[model samples]
Target: MRVAVLPCCLFSLAALAGCATGSKTSEVAQVRMVFPVQAPARPQCDAKPLERLALTGQVASQELIDQALHDSRAAHARVMRDDHVADASINPARLNLRVSVDNRIISSSCG
Candidate 1:
């Protein structure tokens, strides 16, 4: 019984050797823009300073994508889409807005 138990313990330890170590930090970033309602010709440069916004806690990627679509849809600026029209109300007025964003993962704390 002792001999059998010794082999089982050794096997378990070997199997878990890799699992005991921590993984390297991963770098990831994403950007999203949304327009729920009509936007001004030149929307005011109203970005909150980094300190004022919440970058941590609980947020999902899909939510951000949905927001980007919604915001782009609502912007009043002319976007270059094939279906776009300059209009008299008879034809639909397609939006012409451009949204670009960048993100980076820095090795910093949330203080």
Candidate 2:
């Protein structure tokens, strides 16, 4: 009877220890999978045109701007000074037009 009881006690303790260790490992793995690491920020000046439009260095016309805006599918469109264009927010669904004082399009970009 004593021998049998000793073996049973040892086996129970081992099973408990194994379960505790396994649960900890699984919890850590779950946390790592649920939380993702962030990537590096992209450059601000790397904007690209959403559609093919001959806008750069051209006279800014309402018709041309409207066409460009339509093609871009931007949620917001704004005509800003050429100098202020660099400071504009680059949004995937936004379009920015850098125009000179004479209403000529100096540059255009989309995110």
Candidate 3:
């Protein structure tokens, strides 16, 4: 009887170990965080035709700004795996992002 029980005990342990190694389903509550970004100040300029030149310059270089934003979003997603990026807004003042992040992993990632 002891020998029979030993086999049963070992089989239970093996089954438990398999369960431990499998993916765990966990509920992650809503996560919210605010990050302040200093918006770049618009260049000081007089209201004249020359302002058109500045505007043109800004428009032409907009691609760089867009690239920067793409990089930022990608980096944020990589760091916060549980949180999905809901929205991103950039005004003259700052960049604000609303992320549906996994609060469970946020603490571990320190984001």
RMSD of each: 21.5, 6.5, 20.2
Tens digits of per-residue lDDT, candidate 3, 16-107, equal 98776663422112121244456875533122332223322232234533442343332322222234553333233222222223222221
TM-score of each model, paired residue for residue: 0.20, 0.46, 0.23
Q: Native-vs-model 1 lDDT?
A: 0.34
* lDDT by residue (tens digit), candidate 2, 1-111: 999999999999999999999999999999989997789764332234533677877777888877777776565567788655355355775667879988888877776
The lDDT, on a scale of 0 to 1, for candidate 2 is 0.73
Top candidate (TM-score): 2
Alpha-carbon local distance difference test for all models: 0.34, 0.73, 0.35
- The local lDDT score (0 to 100) that residue 59 gets in candidate 1 is 35
1 or 3, greater by TM-score? 3
Tens-digit per-residue lDDT, 1-111, candidate 1: 999999999999986774554221111111122324465564321213222333323232445423433443432222222233433332122222222222221111110
Candidate with maximal lDDT: 2
Q: Which portions of model 2 miss their true places by more than 4 Å?
A: 1-51, 83-88
Quote the positional error of residue 100 for candidate 1 in Å. 50
lDDT (0-100) at residue 82 of candidate 3? Answer: 32
**What local lDDT does model 2 show for residue 38?**
86
